[model samples]
Target: MNLNQKKSAFIALGQFLSQFSLDNSARKEGVLHNDLFFDKFIDLIELSQSHNGWFTPEQVHYAINSWAEALTEENLNEWLSAYDLSNVQPKTVGLILAGNIPLVGFHDFLSVLITGHKVLVKTSSNDQKLLPFLADYLIAVASEMADNIEFVEGKLENFDAVIATGSNNTARYFEYYFKDVPSIIRKNRNSVAVLDGKESKEDLVALGEDIFRYFGLGCRNVSKLFVPKGYDFKQFFEAIYEYGDIIHYEKYANNYDYNKAVFLMSLFPLLDNEFLTLKEDSSYASPISSVFYEYYDDLETVKSKLLEDSEKIQCIVSNNLINRSISFGKSQKPKLCDYADNVDTISFLSKI
Candidate 1:
């Protein structure tokens, strides 16, 4: 359908998503096709963990809430206003999605469709259900969406361009396979925070949210910290103590125990909370239950190092210490315009 029609369908999906949250899933009147979709959506949320252990009901609901907040009419209008899609030609755009977090590749799916193109999605096995369920809701809201969205079980084919997200290894395969077509191939990138020893307890607590949310699977999650030398761990550890309950999750606890054992056996010194471990390292991508940290001599040197290694970083969280750094805990709550890897999806879609 046209732009407004497509936007309206997504708005309806967002409204549907708003009915569910970590605390409760309440059905609201006036939401489109709720009779057919609401209870089933709740069922899916309850069943999500069976499909993927990482898809805990709480985390799934958080993801749903995040998207609901993002897909408002005003937000959609503001985001799409920047692009000219009036003269667009429809093409089939293939997507190879990542299953790291619930509905992780949805922005790319929305991007392809909103730009007046057909979407051929190859869902990651870990996240095969959520987006297609939303797609069905969209089709029910606007019948034309049936023609615009398709999920492929086998290999992707007959698409003009592709958007693929994967590890650095799979990205190489995507680059070689989709080399002929204009493509956006995403690779592993991690976010980091800069600490100057002046952050308040509130800020550190919020920073804990950035660290522990979704159990640190998302690229936007702060996986590393750049702290000034001699920064005390007493305040930081106390501030993040609220997140200690995260250790109760079996998978997370297992990772914590295993990783900690490996670290100890290797003679690496560590700062251990009951739930999370902090190790001093220069690496950006930390293991699931740990966050790496480095000492920075000065802010300018850290900024220069980050700039020099920009391609490897997804986000920088700080209290205005670094240019373009996000606030303490806002990394995972990126705006619609916060393109991954700093690549503009809308502009890419408009051109293709």
Candidate 2:
């Protein structure tokens, strides 16, 4: 199918997704395939939790809403405007998805299809249900897409290029395995927030969203903090107090209790706020329910360090303290143009 046809199909999928939310799921009349697929989609969303304990309704709905906002005609047109897709020849692109969060690999899926290439997707077992369901919806909306999309269960084969997401160890395996093909092998990267000790209560509260959203499982979640020397976290803790309800989730509570006990037994210093723990750590990857923090004497030094270790960082959140650093609370809510790892997926797909 052509570019306009592909864009229309995804826009319809977005309209269908906009109907469902944690707060409300009022099925609108005009959304394509609503009569046949709407209720089934809702059932799948409800059943998602059984498939993956972390895929709670609230988290699934948030992911859905984010995509709904992203796949608008305006957003789609603007995102695709930067690329020349008309001269594309169809190629099979293999996608090995990461299921750390809901619909984590949807962007790659969209890129392959929108750029006139076929996609062979191997869904992460943790997220096996959602994307295939949406793919089915897209096919129903535009039957031409059925030939372009395939979900592989066992081995990924018969593809010209590959895009895979995994931990650093698995990324090494991907590099070795896909050595002969054009690829984007994504490794584990964490986001961090730089605190200047001057942020407003609202900014800190928003920063709490960055830290706790998706239970801090997604890469975009701020797992580390860079604070000024002798920075007091009293206000930061107080501002995030509203999210204390997160501890009510059994899985999160188990993690919090376990991680806390492990730290205490190891005699590590910690700042606990009942639900979340803050530990002085130089590491970027923090455990669930805990955030690693390090003190910085100067912004330039921190910037230099981050620049030197850019590959390990996915995003930097600040009040423009460093160039291209996103604002507080907005890390997880990435725009269509905000490519992960600063690798332009669209441009890469256009070339390959």
Query: Which number leads on lDDT?
Result: 2
Q: Compared to the true structure, candidate 1 yields what TM-score?
A: 0.99
Q: Which stretches of candidate 1 lie over 4 Å from their true place?
A: none
Clashing pairs for model 1 are none
lDDT of each: 0.94, 0.95
lDDT, residue 65, model 1: 93
- Count backbone clashes in candidate 1: 0
lDDT of 1 by residue, 230-333 (tens): 99989999999999999999999999999999999999999998788999998899999999999988999999999998999999999999988999889989
Candidate 2 local lDDT, 81-123, one digit each (tens): 9888877778999999999999999999999999999999999
> Alpha carbon lDDT of residue 41, candidate 1?
92
